[model samples]
Target: MKMDYVSSGIGKTDFLQLRKLYPLFVFSRVSWENRLDHLYIEYEFWTGKNSRNALFFRPSLKVYGRPIEKGSAEWLDPFLFQLGLIELISYWKATCSPEILIQAGSLAASQIKWWQKLYLKGLGEFFFRNGIERDYPGILHIECDSAKQFRPVEIFSLQGNLIPVGGGKDSFLTLEWMKEEKENNLCFLLNPIKAQWDTLRYFSYPLDQVIVVERQIDSLLLGLNKKGFLNGHTPFSALLAFLGTMLMALYKIKNYVASQESSANHPTVPSESINHQYSKSYEFERDFQKFLADSLCPSFSYFSLLRPLSEIQIARLISEIPGALSVFQSCNKNRHCGGWCGHCAKCLFSFLIFRPFVEAQKISGIFGSDLLEKQSLFSLFLSLCGKAEQRPFECLGTEEESLAAASLLWHKAKATGKKPPVLIEKLFSQYPHLLMTRNAIQATYDLVNTEHSLPKKFLSLLQKNVIKKALFDD
Candidate 1:
């Protein structure tokens, strides 16, 4: 299962070495079948002539509630093939092969271009972290020689919505806003963690109403990462988008509702195109909608319900919903631990945003400690507030949002006649000019970015929820 021959930490030299060693990576084939409890999907990949270089990945979706009638292969093959295409990114990163031969299914020239863009932008963080310099036209070459072109399914009328939940504050707010439509909504979780399950329970959504996808990454890829082939962040949300399409078709759901906010549009590295949240950006959302309309099912709808709002607004809204706030968890580092890690950027950002609205003691309790008080997080705070050279490679709000949140917290602490946290004091002392005015902070809380794909009904629901919470002064 492990390759001991692979070298470790050669940087760009290693990248060049891997590509030279493994010139061509092939998507050999894909196979799937419906078992008694779940739909099993598998993909085979290999590089070079040695059979020892082959890699296999198997990811499954657990079938719950009603038994899914197996649709025709013609109707199902495209979805499964597309899923494999996205799933291959994990394995492909191990050795940045120059050419990818797709023998499993054929893709049109335009489809090939789409996948290329996804891979390039999706792997932006990967390339930057590994210090690999790659240009668009010269980076990768994807060729599909398979003569079989899977036909797109024309869906007539699919009802209700499929909401993907990650047990985060954004999705938690989305679930609360859609509570009236609970019966019509099908909640989805990929590899559910304890926090995710607890979030559903808090919302009173039973298991039968949830779609659980159990994805297993091949151990070979992990082994390669340890051997230092090449590894970093991939566009996981992109994979989720493809998987969402499959779920919609199988369950006959009309809309694919996600919880990505407008803040995701900001690039992690300023003055460049590299974004850690590229897949969740509005650009990706817009392109995906068009891809669905032109290439895939035209009737299906996909959009993030919270796209219009900023992270500050989401935090403020969640502060109003006490029960939902109690169960939500956003710390990626501590996701498996079912609590905040209190050290990562995600934890610090969550704490900074919620501190202005939630009671100080309660916020501290939720995160297990006051994150701003930790001197160890000062560097992360600077990066988040635009003081550092680059932002932390995480899904975070824009620099302006971070400053606004910090300003609000600082002003609140001053108003309450309490000592400000260590990080807050350091931030203000170092960069007093970055402090936001009251009017500016209020505008951020009330503002809504117009670049979203939400239909009128979804927009109406979002506005209604904002009004109901009454977080802002009207």
Candidate 2:
């Protein structure tokens, strides 16, 4: 018999928890943003009235059949050294759609199904919405089935530990928390970096010894171009699973710790995405946790360390902790010449969130630029302060933050020449017109003068917390 079909487009997601949405179609005019060529994606899944052994998959996506230079962003001369966004795009297309355009086996897109969605919605609202700074709306149209199609994933306990790392907030907080709990004897994964470990140095993590996984997907990527195999999102979970398997095969430590922030629970909005943010949702976390358990040999565990903190809270923690803000760079697309390259949305949000703790001058210095020249940045940021047509999981702060940053910008504009930063001058031109910006400044100042609510969240997850005791009991 043919498989029963269930699918949908994800609309304004309930931040943190994974709720179900059917018939979801995420459409975006990305070319307007000058980011890429215009394209769209559609995702579908199936779960029948009966079938315990249901298959998890993504329908194939056939995008960019030609060169990106020919209006296919796929071929736009790659980032200075980075690899491919198409790898992610193609992965999403094939795994959810019925088509089989790409041959990159199961990545994280498997969670774009029904079982995962319901599971997360069942959990209390302990999730983060989309945190990327994209101006796209998620329109997931859900199609439900009454019969059972839940393919339970087996959890494998392992004898090995996986330490996920990058040069950013999640890994830094995770490593610190783990070490404080005396779980220093875990494994570490580094994706063939050109520099020394980024987050590890932040907390002065003791390094008597540890397990490490270094991937070499670069040449494999270029070589696989003729057919142009698109790799879905990093099987970050799978990578950890393989680490657990390696531990079983080698050292035998199954405690793999994923440093993904709780904020990652906020899904990403894809331009032309028919469905959005499937991999990072809470449902994915829970189901994949089980999938790893079921598929692995035995004794493996993967869990996010920052499940309790918001992005702002996470940023607050990073600031209080030394060395984190000083050396991390999180942008993927940029024309920057120095540090943090404050052009990408990541850098902009990081600076905005840090407004309370660090002065603007210090932040610009850290990112290796002065605010005097970032006219377009202030424009994009000011836009967020106003009401959004679709309130997404924006990385931008509230009215308080926008005003605080704007106050600083206004002061700087007083000294700036009458050029394109006219918006800067406009801030003070009519106070009532920029009500949101004004309110944001007042809120920011009030909060700052008050007890400061940012770092409190991290303090709960610190060394003294009772749950933390079990996390580091190595």
TM-score of each: 0.94, 0.51
Top lDDT model = 1
Residue 225 deviation, candidate 1, in Å? Answer: 1.1
lDDT of each: 0.83, 0.39
lDDT of 1 by residue, 40-155 (tens): 77778887545476545443444444456345334777887888888888888888889999999899889899989899999999888777764734669999978988766796
| Model 2 TM-score, all chains together | 0.51
Model 1 residue 83 CA deviation in Å? 1.0
**Tens digits of per-residue lDDT for model 2, 124-147:** 111112232122134222222222
Candidate 1 structure lDDT: 0.83
